[model samples]
Target chain A: MTDVVVAGGGLIGLAVAWRAARRGLTVTVVDEAPGRGASEAAAGMLAPVTEAGYREESLLRLGLASLERWPAFAAELEAAGGLPVGLRTVGTLVVGFDDDDMRQLEALHDFQQELGLSAARLLPRAARRREPSLTSRIRGGLLVAGDHSVDGRAVHAALLAAAEAAGVTLVRDRVEGVVVDGGRATGLRLRSGGTVPAGSVVVALGAHSAGLPGLPPVPVRPVKGQILRMAGAAGLLDGTVRALVRGRHVYLVPYGEDRLIIGATTEDRGFDPTVTAGGVHDLLHDAIEVVPGVSELELAETLARWRPGTPDNAPLLGPTAVPGLVLATGHHRNGVLLTPVTADAIADLLATGELPDRAAPFTVDRFEAP
Target chain B: MTDVVVAGGGLIGLAVAWRAARRGLTVTVVDEAPGRGASEAAAGMLAPVTEAGYREESLLRLGLASLERWPAFAAELEAAGGLPVGLRTVGTLVVGFDDDDMRQLEALHDFQQELGLSAARLLPRAARRREPSLTSRIRGGLLVAGDHSVDGRAVHAALLAAAEAAGVTLVRDRVEGVVVDGGRATGLRLRSGGTVPAGSVVVALGAHSAGLPGLPPVPVRPVKGQILRMAGAAGLLDGTVRALVRGRHVYLVPYGEDRLIIGATTEDRGFDPTVTAGGVHDLLHDAIEVVPGVSELELAETLARWRPGTPDNAPLLGPTAVPGLVLATGHHRNGVLLTPVTADAIADLLATGELPDRAAPFTVDRFEAP
Candidate 1:
């Protein structure tokens, strides 16, 4: 029997399985579409606070912790996979246009200060000074120093490579059910009428985690987002900037040599993920507002995607009610941010049969109604 | 005399021209590579709230206004081009897991309500009951009803058809510079040494607007975004659901027939629009968290593109400081959402030689102070 049977082959699952295999545990990851979930479509922004607003502190903490581990984790993955994961600690600048936006920034700054985290700093002209591409609409800004970013898709590829390199079996099959014997997960039943036994099972499904049977019910949901991309002169902006210009949330992220990353729109209307004229129009309009020079760049592509979300907006990690079933799903926006932490935590849990304190808050049991 | 000479053939430029032409004004459009740009790469979602929050009220207002006009605009385009623009007003839902996440939902609801908008609603358990696929772990949700969506690529095709049908001259050549007669814009100088004379000019170059010279400086900057597309079980999701999930900012948009739209990451490193391994991995991970059944889907495509950005994160619209040179660049993130408004506003401005109230806040004058 395999030491671990990962039900999904997403970044989280593969990272865990790869880490487990490195610890001399036999691991098998079962997924029909190995790299076609939310993990593949994500923007890979490793910002914990930029994504946090009201009370997603737990998730923010987890993301921050994972962000702390990203450098080392990415290095390890690179060593195993012989690839660069595009990990960078360039920091993020949250800029505002007017008084109301500055108020919002101040509130966020106060919250960050209260966390005893040196993640954000207020900027006046310093924001535009650091990145000259910024227009002189001249307003206040918040610089999140601790937060960094990575290429989510690259990390996914590296994880898959690392997992295979570490001798974890990657099987392509849809998991239909979990094989439970006496309230313990023994294996996973495949849709093709096949079963693979394991000493432990972990469900690392992203948005689709709810469809899997025989688990504590997960409140995972699908959130659709659309993004636009363009190609221009490289080195347009120095670091990631979340523009609070005119009370509109827009971002300009540069990723090596004439490419800029801008996105996205959130929508909830079932599963109609089609690129729309209105979506494209909005992206261009706002992008132009932030960097006016973008009007001259060549647009490379536009995309729409879905992100898997949990009830608390925190990932479901560590042990479940089932004895041998460990849950590692529900990492919505921070999947890339939490990748390193997830791999390390799941590996530690599988190795010692217990979760660390950092992962305790993200336990699947948190979803229980009680 | 033509009031504007739009210097691009993509959806944004064409839409502006189509609207301008409809306003009983002579308009000429020059394009090097028409029908490309973020318009080609976008998965259109007309969700202002879904794309809201970076404190982008101007863009949100613009998106809402355009969304209000989308149905009629799409119908007009259809009437002109004899093709459907794939416009649909399917609302969006932003869901949360627990009390902490509920805070974000509440904040969004409050903000929407404060905006005097009827598009958003706070959904309880009963609201989620309509879709059984939604996990029981949902704490609550916020639904944005007025937000709609469409297929951008389809609209691009239809816009070309409509533009040609609207008597707008479509020129195929790279724009070298603006032809200025007596310090007033007259036409475009092609890269092949051909000059196309016009009464005026509109620099609707999308991300590439900065590359052109002898026009108003748009200050357009390119932002890159990467995305992945997958084909899942047909009719997998009921509508679009976005989650401020786990500090990762993820969403799942279903585009009919088992195909789900998954995406994207924001990076500012410059113009290498190649699909990376990490992007695919992160997208898959997040997607599975919301819909566990997607492991059974197939990955159809992976894409990367750039978006144009401006200084204040708002688009530059209306007339420029240069005589006879109207500016319509710097539309970074809200290009798609602002298509209708942009088109109508440009048309009105061209016909009446006066800027509309909606275009006042997004003027190029805001960037002139520096």
Candidate 2:
């Protein structure tokens, strides 16, 4: 019998399996398209200061803690997988371009400072001196020196390799249902009508984790995002720049080999994978305004994917009502950002049958059935 | 007696002197400071496309025609002043961040297309591929490939030098009043109690134009703007990023020596030239969204100035009721943009004794006197 069956092969599931196997659990990750979800299209910005907002105080705290884990997570992944996940220690800059925007930024800054975060306000001259190409139109900005980034693609690759190396079986097959016997998760039903018995099961299918056999529908649904990448001369940007361009969440993250990633559109279109023209257009428009230099770079690729979102915009973690069943989905825009924390907590539960205190607030029973 | 006594030493006055002197008119620019005014705080965006709106067709036409004159104008100035006014032909990217922004952008795009302009819609890939640092959250964008920019400080210097080189006299004194003898313009009365007679007097005092002694109050008022400058390593940005960031005009213009210019909060606060903290905050916020790399750059300077604005947002040019007294102020945010055409048209009026057809539409009579 498999000690654990994680119902996904995306970052969260692979990470969980990797950790579970490290704790000596026999684990299997079942995914039709391995490593293809929100994680694949993420900008990988470990931005707690920029991502923090109203009604997300707990998530902000969790994200800040997760950001702390990323450095060690990347180091361990490199040691285990023999490939360095591209983690850059360069900081993040949050900026505003108008009066109203500045007011909002100041409010956020006040909140960040109140939280005792090491966020510093920089005048336009100081901000532009660091990023020479920065527009002089910037009124002022906040510098989050602690906020860093890891390459999303590199992280995905490393997790897959590290998980496999840790004796976690990656089954490239669709999950049909969960086998429930005596009010407990007994195994996973494969799309090919095969049954894999497991002592415990974790549903971590990202945006597709809402419906499962014998479980009520979760509030988790697909929120499609369109992200794009461009290649240019190296060091065009040394770090991440996140901003509310007219109240929109526009971020530019520069990664390995001169690749600049721009994203995403927070959309509620359920399960739609089509990359609409408007989504791509909005991204470019906002990006170019902040970085006029972007209009000169080379176009690389356009991608669209779905992120798992819950009503509260926080991930559901820990156990379900079923005795041996667990939950880890709805990471939303933060699935990649939350991987290390999610993996550790889930592995703890799978190995010791107890959820960590850090994972307690993100319980599965927080929301009603969708 | 000078054929033309320009009652302001800003770019419009200098450009007019340069042209009128070139046409063999005895031109005297009576200005306390020649290279100052709103032109000193300008980003020098020749952007009719981003600036056009309903009821602004004539100004748009005039702007486009002025944009056409820029190349030749720059060459002529370079020849006369021996200074290379940096004119970047890289174009302008007009961006939008969210759905509402996209809708507004699409409407502008539609209007641009209807006007038969060479505006093209750019996908995220194409846009980011070009700039590489552009944020992916841009909902949509249009490339106004013909809309270019010039360095404001360089242009200001060149205009002053070129005007002096073209046989224009620079009278460094404050014009206390326009001497409208027998209800016709004759000359200017200086604050120093010196009278300089001219065949015609052109009021080009920018935001300070309203308080002239004999002129009835036009609908022009002083609108204060704060702009900023930053220095960075070379090749940070290639062009200009203009956006209505949450309905406010925010622009990022890149110039020589890796200087990024961010600017101009449109406020009705009336002649206030103090740089507020909120003003700078908004610009950096919106600008950083498009170019995350900006945070790494250096910040240089913060500046505040007053722009002469009119009710209809168009300049008051050509003749007033006082025959030899012409109105040449109220260029608003477009003063630097409209310099060349304004110079040519005003020079034609001074030389030929009649307003050009293009200048006729922008006469002071178009607006009821306030």
Candidate 3:
């Protein structure tokens, strides 16, 4: 029997398994196809400061904690996996195109200032000076120097490699249900009709984590997002550019030398991964509105994926009602941003069977009836 | 020695070879990859009436002649190839978005009327009645009942099958130059260092027919065009929609049940085939402006190709200056629409050693300094 069994082999599950294995615990991850799902489409923006909201201060703190661990985490993973995760610290520019967009940006800037976040307000000219590819039509923007990005797909690949190097066994199969014996989660029952008993089980199936037959109730829903990947954008922008065109949100994140990820449209439709024409047009339209030079790049690909969303938009992590069962899913749009902290916290619990104090507030019990 | 060696395998060359084979003349076609180049991107708009220009009366006559032969040609080819060529007899609508566009359409309509073409002028509402998917912002339009369309790719595939079925040898090799001997065109020198000896050599390489070694000067320049292919537009438009959006021209041609071709931009950029962001943006912006519903269709593909353009924009379709050398290229934007007439005319010349009367006016000598 394995010491721990992870139900998904995405970035979260792989990272948790790797960390658990490093703590002298045997680990096995089961997934039909690992490193896919939302991890495949994440833009990898670690912009805790820019993404901070008014009432979601706790989520903001969690994002900052993960952001703080990214540098060391990336270095250690690169050394172990022998792969570069394309982490760039050039920061992000959040621009607004019209008067209404500027007003919203101004309000966000005030909130960031109230929270003592490190963001600088910039005029249209100043914003364009930082990223010359930006359109002259932008009204204003905010530059958060602490905000950064990485290539999410690269990170997932590196995590898989690092986890394998750390002696974590990877089972390429689907988890049909939690193998619960005596009201305690024991292992995973795979779609291939095989079972691997474990001392503990971690559910990390992203949007598919909800309503497993033998598991406690988990509140996760699929929030569909349509994104476009473009190429030939080398030196177009120094960093990421998130914009509000009128009232709609759009972002362009430069991944490698000439590849830019333009995204996305948030729809509540469940698990329908159809990349619609309106979604692409809206993304391209707003991207061109913010960065005019994007109109000259090659549209490399278009994809739609589900971000595992919860009611409060914060990830559900740590211990659950069922003994020997853990929850480390529901990262929503911040899955890539929170991968490091979620992995360490969940792995700590899996090894010692105690939820870390910092991660205790994010347990499933927080969402249960008061 | 073979009777004929055609130096391209695109729609024009394939059709001509098939027709010649049907006339009991042995033929061989040389192309590294058959039915590609501009043939792959042609929108297959058979709109001689609507495409009629003021100074292009001769070209208009040629297009009308080809359009007249398309029905019989498609039927015979489909019968021989055993494949449906997706020929739609639904007429074409040339619409206008603004006053300038409307005035341009009106002038073109006047020219068509003067040429005795079958076109009916329609008001905005009447035009919408014809194609309900057209945006209400259309100022006016002209409906040409005689114009029609076909699936260019489907036609090429069918032509390939028909040509092979007619005992035409398809040499999947590139033609390096015309094999000239004793001041007479004999055959073709292939890129594979092989020589194909023939009684006659037909230079049908489209834009690449201009300056081949050992061949007479054929004034064909590559006119770059970028186009878009979309899907999920099964019933978006009843027929083709050719629109003048502001001062720009955009056409939407529906082929199979759900595929729509949106095209294109005319650039004199020499043989560059990079599908730029500006090119796709312009096509999509104008397409959406003309038919708002196009914003909902999937952008299936984006491609750029070069059209063999001539000074008069009319194809050179007869024997050239070199002995035993025939010119059957330079169809420009009308390649697919002109395939039937060009094939019949060129095949007649090859089989009888005399240029057909209709194709005689389009010889390379027409552009002589005399």
Candidate 4:
């Protein structure tokens, strides 16, 4: 029997398992193929200020809180795992091409200012000065100097290593369902006709959370996203460039020496993993429109994955009505952004049996009756 | 000792070896990795009439001669190899998008008419009737009912099987250079520190022909090309759509049920094999401009290879200046189209020491100073 068993081995599940095991708890993570889900496709943009919305202030605060803990978390994890997490604090530039896009950026900038976030609006020339690879056709932009990014794949890898180092048992098999007895969550039923008995179970299956048996209704839905990874762009840009070409949104994040992460298209087409040509064309079209030099880089890879979207695009991060079963999935596009905070809060709950004050508002019960 | 040793196991070499073996000559082929060069990247367009130019009448005649042999060649090869060659004779449509493109199409049509080729100029509506997926923005087009195509990879596979089945020895070793003694080519020195002795040697190394030692200057240069293969394009186009978008040229060839071959860019950058972003962007942009539905297909693959180019853009067939050293390279963009004729002509020459009348004009001695 384990002190805690995690149903998925993605970044979220592995992070929670590692943190909990470090706090003197026996942990087990069960996944057929860990980190091959949304964790593998993330661009790792941790831009809470630039990505903040009007009515989602609490989510914004949560993102800011998570962003605040990233540096320390990355340092500790690097020490524990002996691997680099590829964290960069070079900031992000959000630019707009046309009048409508400019108005949208202005509105977002005003909102960021009202929230007292650290962002500066820039004209086309100023934006181009900040990042010379940007074309001169840009109208205006907003530079969020505090919003940084990390490499998502690297973080997942480091988490796996750290969890293994922390003595977290990794079960390379699928979790078919949660084993419940007497109206309390007890263990996980494995696909290989076995069961993992645990004091608690953390369901962090991301988009698959909605379909898992023996779990209550999770309002999570699979939102498909198509993205491209390009190489041979050694000096194309200094940092991340989020742009609105006409009315569509696209972002280019420079990673490593010659790699650029160009993404992505959010489609509501339910778990379809085909990287469509239109998705690639729209991404490249807008990316090239904002930065013409993008056309000269090599398109190294194209991928499609699902983001576990909630009704309000905020993650569910606390205990559910089921007693021993906790919910830690539905980070959506911000799984990489919110990794540190989610791990700390979930591991803290497992240790102290109480959800943290900052994480209380995001409980799954908020979506249930009153 | 073998009767013949061919250096290079590409479509040209394998086809020659297969045909010569069928004519009672023991043959051996030497290559490091067979059919992974320009043969794998060829778009397989046999469009001699639609691709006709002002000064390349002899090349056009040679293309027509090979085109005439394709049906019988494909049938016999399929019978010998037990594989489909994906040969489609549904013809091709040469389309134009803008005024300059329309003028160029009209000039090409005039030249084809002067040469008494079978081609008809069509209005945009009539062109759309042939390939309904073509965009309505097309200005005009030329319908060449004789132009055809084959799947290059499928042809390579079939040729491999046919060559193997015909008892031609396949040596999976790189050819270092020709082996010459007493002023006559004897065999080939291999990269594996071994040699393949033969009665005669055939130099069919494509772009690498110029770099082989112990052989005279072959006048071949590498012309780099980048191409893409896309899937999920079932029923997108009937045959092939060769379009002149603005001043640039692009082509889309359909293979199987759901795969489309979109190509390409011609650059003189030697042997650089990186598939540039500009090349992909231009291809997708022009393909979408010609057929809007192209944007919805999946980009299955991207590849870069080099074509063996000559001064006159015609092949250097028959014997070279070196005795017992025959030449069958420099097919350029027309290797797949000229495969059958090249095989037959070279095999005929090997059986009897006389170059055919049609193939005699393309000898390497033509490039020698008078």
Candidate 5:
């Protein structure tokens, strides 16, 4: 019998195992593919300012905190795992092609200022000079030197190593259900007809952490994001460039040895991992528009993966109403960014029976019972 | 007698003198201060895409043509003037912080693509990653990587040196008026009561090109632009950053030994050259919003200069009703970008007695008679 039986093997579950095992807990993480899920295809942008929206201030705060914790987390993860997570602090440059984009950027800047955050405005020339590959038609830009990125693959690899190094067991199999005792989750049942007993159950199964038999339904839906990887000469791009191009959100993330990630097409189709040609075409078209240098890079792979998203776009980080059953799913697009904070929250809860204040707004109680 | 007697020794006048001199014509340029017009305070952006509008296709074509001519023009000016003009083809990045700005930028991109001009869309992360100082609040951006800028003061100095090297005579005095001879305009009268005899008269007086005695009302008026010169370490900004912050056209130009030119608050106060504190405060406030690094730079000087603007916002170039009195003024915000083209048109007219096709649409005859 283990102290904690985690039902997932993605970044969240692995991170939980790593954190909990470091705290002297006997933790076991189960998943069909440990490094799969959205983590395999995400361009981990730890951006609070660019990703902030009108009413998502809580998410912004959480993201910012996670971003702040990333440096120390990565350092510790590397020391523990003996693997480096590709983290780059090259910053971000938000460029506009015309007056309308500039106006929206100004409004965003004003909102940022109102929220007491610092955002720098750049005239067109300054922006282009920084990124020479940027088109000349851009009107102006804003600079957020603090927004950084990490290599998701490296992070996942590091998490795996760290979890292994910390004495957490990884079971490469699908989680069938949670073993319940007196209507409270006690452990996980593997698909191989094996039951693993534990002192507490933690479900960090990402998009699959929903509608298990006799378990409370978590309202996280599968959001399919198609991403493209390109191998290029080093220095094709500096950091990441995100744009709302014709009302569509697109970005280019550069990480590792000249590995460029041009992604991602978001679709509402559930449980689908189809890499549509239209998705690839649109990504390449927009990618070439922003950074013409992308065309010169080699096409590596097109990956389609599922992210678990909640209705309000925030993750459920703390415990559920079911006794001994803690939840850490529905991170959606921010799972990579929220990895550090989520690990801390779940570890603290398992070690000390309490969730931190940062995890308060992200509790599973926000949603109606199903 | 000189073949061309040019009034107003700004960039346009000096460029025309240099071009005409290169074409083996005896050119004389007269002005009270050769580098004291709008050229002294212009952020010489060679942007056809950003400056082009719905009904301003003709100006766009002219600007694009001038942009095409700039590389060779700069090269020739460099060889002739023995000075660097700082023509940086750093391109332009247009960024938006909110939805409104992105929508406007989309419309502009659609319009540009409709006109067969290329504009690329960028996501916010990509933009911020390229420019580190940019705020993450920016929503998205467009890339016009072809648009560029030059050091205006350097261009002016190079133009002066080029004109002098090309054997064009420079008279340091104000022209009283264009001396009309039998309705065919022959020469200019100096303010010191001296008559300058010439084969043809070219009025290149920016902002002050109209309402002189013995000359027809040219329908040009003075638009005062207040600018700030900040002395800082070099590379504070990459190129130029232009913003229509709350619908006001503002920009920052980086040139000359860590000099940043925050400039030219547009006003319709009719030749008022007072550098108001409100203007400087607003400029500094807005400049810091985009590039937080601007706050650390030292304020060197405040400059206010007048630009000659016409009703339709296009320059009055080439021929007027009076045969020998060619018109070359009313270039408002585009004098720096249009300098090369204007020089060619005026020089071609002075040398071969015909205006080029590119300058045909911007002739003085388009205006109503005064």
Candidate 6:
């Protein structure tokens, strides 16, 4: 029997499987579709503060800790995968356009300060002068120094390679249901009618977690988001700028040579991922307000997807009511943000059979009513 | 003097200039990087109702008219450019998961019926039986017969070829400002300090119009989005499936034999166009949920871009307050959808200096405070 049978092979699941295998545990990840879940559709922004304000302080603390651990985590993955994950320490600058934005920025700053977090700093004209591409119509800006970013695709690739190197078996099969004898989780039944027994089962099914049978009811839901991708002229944008410009949320992120990442509209309108004209219009209008030069860039692609959001918007982690079944799903917006921490936490849990403090607050029982 | 000097050579600007030039009017288009912008990133989803909302009736109507004119437009463009824009009339199927989704589907169905439009139909079990690969979990679907799609990149390329063939001078110049003399539009001053004179200037700048100074204040905003381009296992998804499966908005647009377009997220985080971990995670999650077989496909590209949007969520077309400047900005998401109409409308206005009825509703006056 394997030490752990990861039910999904997305970034979260694969990372856990890889870390557990590194610790000399036999790991097998059963996923009919690997690397094709929320991991593939994410922008890979590692901003704990930028993504904060979801009313889950424990999850926020865990995310902040993961951000702290990201450098080492990325280095290890690079060493294992033999490729740079484009891990850039370039800070994210959140700028404001008018007075109302200033008020919002101040509130966010106050919240970060209350957390004893040095993640954000207000930037004046002198700081903005460092970046010449910034428009003249600037009020003030917030610099989220601790928040960093990485190439999410590179991480996914690295995890796959690292997991394979660590001797984790990645079986491609649709997990129809979990094999449970009495109250303990035993294994997974594949859609192909095959069965594989396991010492433990980690339910990391992302948005599809609630649908999987043999597990206690998990409250995972899908939140639809649409995005657009464009290729800019080389050296178009200098650093990451998250702007509250022209009364709209806009961000300009530059990557290697001529690629700029732009995005996303959040809608609860169940999984109808058609590229709408309205979604596109909203994106372009806000983008141009911040960076007029984008008008000159070539549009590379337009896309849409669904984020796996939990009721609380925080991921469910660690142990479940079942003895051998652990829950590792419901990482709504922060699956990419919490990847390293999740991997390490799950690996630690599998080794010790005890939940870590970092993942303690994200228990599946949070959604259960007394 | 030329009727108009378009400040960009993208599909939006060029199509407008081309239509005007075809109508026995002299036109010049100034573009630093022509045939780019969101036009290059777009998959050319000509879907109006597929992208419609209860409030977006006007935009939907405009999209429907363009969809009706698309076949003839492509044919005309092909005739002029000796190149084909891959325009397919294969209707889109918006798939649903369960009873709750059927309610949303019914609402959209009701909306379609109320419009007296026959382009959409409700697909039941009998119709869905034709496609066996679709999961049994699907309760029902909406068939948008009028909503079609095109290869947006191909259309952009074809437009360039067509524009060149139609005797329009495509000059490579970064327009600095419009040369206004005596409160009348004269020409454009280039970044290179050169000047080109014309009778009028049309700002069809897509997401970049907000930066061009000395223009009527048009509230253009940017909405960022991300997408993934995958190579399916030779005919994985037949035609386009605009899926509303389980509240995850996803589109499985099939491009030719193996390429499938899946996407995106709407982010108002300013022009940071980096493809994030979250974006990838969400896209793959929904893609797998909608079409369980997509996991086996090879991921070709993970891309992101920003779309141009307006306040009212509709495009700003027709005349501006500036005498020599005709405002054709703020098509936002429908830039691709309104390409034909915009081109035709702008060309008509340029030749006769009269606003066509089709372009009247989209006038800049709509945004002016009463």
Task: For each candidate in the order shown, give its overall lDDT on alpha carbons.
Answer: 0.76, 0.83, 0.91, 0.93, 0.83, 0.78
- The window of 10 residues in a row where model 4 chain A has the poorest summed lDDT is A273-282
Residue A95 C-alpha lDDT in model 6: 81
In candidate 2, residue A12 scores what lDDT?
91
Please, what are the lDDT tens digits per residue for candidate 1 over residues B1-370?
Answer: 4556788887779998888887766667778778667776666777887666657788778877888888888898999988877775667777776677778777777777777766445565654664445556667777777666676777888888888898888888888888888888888888989877776688887777785778656788887767656665576666666765554655666664566676566666567666643454456555565555555465566677777777777788888777777777777766777888988887777777888998888878787778
Q: Which portions of model 6 show Cα errors greater than 4 Å?
A: A119-124, B1-370
lDDT of 6 by residue, B1-370 (tens): 6667998888888888778878877888999998667776676677888787788888888878877788899899989888778776777788787777777878888888888766455455743654445666677887877777787777887888888888888889898888888888789889999878898888877777876767767788878778777764465655577777677677877766567788667777667767654565567667776777775565567677777788877888888888878877777667777889888887888888898887788888887789
Give the deviation of candidate 4 from the true structure as CA RMSD. Answer: 1.3
On lDDT, the leading prediction is 4
Q: Candidate 4's residue-wise lDDT over A1-370, tens digit each?
A: 9999999999999999999999899999999999999998999999999889889999999999999999999999999999999888999999998899999999999898899998998989999999998999999999999989888888999999999999999999999999888988999999999999999999999999887888999999999999889999998988999998999999998887788999889999898888876788788888999999998788899899999999989999889888899999999889998999999999999999998999998998888775
Among the numbered candidates, top TM-score falls to 4
Query: Mind giving the per-residue lDDT tens digits that candidate 1 earns over A268-370?
Result: 6446566553445456566666666665565566677677777677888888788889888878667888888988899999999989899998897776779
Give the CAPRI rating of model 6. incorrect
Q: Judging by DockQ against the true structure, name the best candidate.
A: 4
After superposing candidate 1, which stretches have Cα over 4 Å from the reference?
A: A119-124, B1-370
lDDT pick, better of 1 and 2 = 2
Ranking by TM-score: 4, 3, 6, 1, 2, 5
DockQ of 6: 0.03
Clashing pairs in 3: none
Ranking by DockQ: 4, 3, 6, 1, 2, 5
How many backbone overlaps does candidate 4 show? 1
- lDDT for model 2: 0.83
How displaced is residue B248 in candidate 2, in Å? Answer: 23
Tell me each candidate's TM-score.
0.53, 0.52, 0.96, 0.98, 0.50, 0.54
Cα lDDT of model 2 by residue, B279-305, tens digit: 655666777777766654555666778
Model 4, B1-370: lDDT tens digits are 9999999999999999999999999999999999998998999998999889889999999999999999999999999999999999999999998999999998999899999999998999999999999999999999999999999899999999999999999999999999999989999999999999998999999999997889998999999999889999998899999999999999999998899999989999998888877788888889999999998888889899999999999999998777899999999999999999999999999999888888988999998999
Would you list the rank order by lDDT, best first? 4, 3, 2, 5, 6, 1
The segments of candidate 5 whose C-alpha lies over 4 angstroms from its true place after superposition are: B1-370
